[model samples]
Target: MQRKIYITIILFLGIVMNAQSGKVGIKTANPKETLDVNGVTYTNSLYLRNPGEPTMTGGSFLATSENALQLYDPNLESSGLFNYLKLSLTGISGAGVTDYDTKIDADKFLIVVHNYSFKMNDGTTNVALDYGDNGTNDNRQGSPDVVAFKSKGTWHIRARFTDSKLIALTSANPGRTYNNFTIDLYLMAYKRLITKQNINDITSDLGGTNGSSKTVNRPSGF
Candidate 1:
């Protein structure tokens, strides 16, 4: 009886070890689509911001602060797109300053800057800006599309506006003339390895199959 019990315990231990060592296939998908994980479906918008007063009226407005980097979820789900991340910004409204440009500047916007440096587990960082033509009707739309990077752990993303100005000369010095300007951002998460593999497979499939009707296996865990 003792021998039999020992054998049973060994068999159970082996099964547990194998289960722990199992591998999960990584996958990628358009963030707009619903993500189903472990028999549950999750759908929501992700927004990140630092704690600070809203943009000012005449003087420099503080859209986001350095220590205010935080994720806001209306639905409040358990799991989120924390690993694979994307950053996008859109100007909603603006006024005053003659020339306006937005880029991923590091020095001035210290608190609201996103990670652009290449490093392991940093995942990928992308940026886009929209600027209206000085004279022509054609407005420039900047879409630095999703850039992916690998991250071994969690990362922070943030952004803020700087170099606020006015076109006309004024001695009075308005309090916050750029009160009309407004900006919005969109954030997304994606697994790195799976994302890379997906792109490679897509290019290969396109070249080999010539856009033929084919179904590729989706990444298992993303």
Candidate 2:
């Protein structure tokens, strides 16, 4: 009986040694990779470092542009939070609203305008205005009060101006014109993959009931 037990141990050790050059599977009979683990794997620490790169910062996830599980590409110029946009307003007269398609889907992405600059030109003259450049008009009709927002699956910038001293220029138009109006926008965007809903009202009664009421009026009332 002792001899049979010794023979069984020797055979098991030999089999393990032979499998060292082949695939090893855990909780599985057939392993597709070198170290295939079919069940959940738990590790105290995980590191994915590039060649010749120093140790990554702790408590933060890091990856390159071509990582296996592509969450975000840190190497991209416009990958993170901030991006830029330049728009030209053409053929717009007087104070009103103008809409531009940002080419960004309203559902999957959320964008916010941080800062902006504008350049207005009439034939040969040009005036540059910053966002907070709402001072009184000098020789030119200063900057218009521009309200930028995103709605209806696009971006809209509405410009309104107060009546100022009339200055001689190209055409007889008050405020700014769309012929040579250009705007530089600094924008921030967030990627979100979820259902979008509009909340008309928000009510909170601590430790009590909560409800919502919303209504829309139309020509054909029902």
Candidate 3:
């Protein structure tokens, strides 16, 4: 009887231990390229045929232009005007450090920027900002994860990572201890729209555009 009881306890403990363990999520900038997770790298067999082609299982559509590379659902529309394009290499690979039951912190990581350039039309310019935390909690605040530049004409845009570091966990599992690390990246872009009036103003001798007449319309039902 004691032997059976011991066996059951051992099995229960094993189950509990397994249940408490979790995995770290991995996200990549390019899905077609093999990603290195916890020092282990694996390539995706599926490839994207074109910008708007359907994505295979475990793969996603990545839009790359001279200015930027963006990941999107395969069902989304493609931008034919982009100068360059690439795939999104994002995923989860190994165990990551946990925070307060909400987030998992990535380990040390680096961002790689691709050099690209393009011609512009109408002398208009576009710009992108590429910035984010290096899996460190403190680095996330007020940082631009990614940026996109679009102007009237074609322009070259490059993507890259500028910094890295170690910080606190942003999220974690319940009742678990973690010292593990994973790399997480956030991408964002800001666009400044230029209008014909502004262009004229900038080129005007007075450095300002002529003011347009203002008119107000009253409610019709009143």
| Model 3 global lDDT (CA atoms, 0 to 1) | 0.31
lDDT of 2 by residue, 164-219 (tens): 22222444333443445445556666554333345344444444434345343432
Look at candidate 1 and tell me the lDDT of residue 113: 25
Q: Give every collision pair in model 2.
A: none
**Model 1 spans > 4 angstroms off:** 1-135, 144-152, 158-181, 185-222
User: By TM-score, who's the top model here?
Assistant: 2
Better of 1 and 3 by TM-score: 1
Give the range where candidate 3 is weakest over 10 consecutive residues by summed lDDT: 102-111
- Model 3: residue 201 alpha-carbon error in angstroms: 13
Compute each candidate's TM-score over C-alphas: 0.20, 0.39, 0.15
Candidate 2, residue 141: lDDT: 47
> 12-41, model 3: which lDDT tens digit per residue?
665454444442223322223232133333
Reference-based TM-score, model 1: 0.20
CA RMSD, predictions in order: 20.1, 13.5, 27.5
Best by lDDT: 2
- Candidate 2 error regions (>4 Å): 1-71, 76-82, 90-97, 122-145, 159-178, 193-222
lDDT of each: 0.31, 0.48, 0.31
Candidate 3, residue 192: Cα displacement in angstroms equals: 18
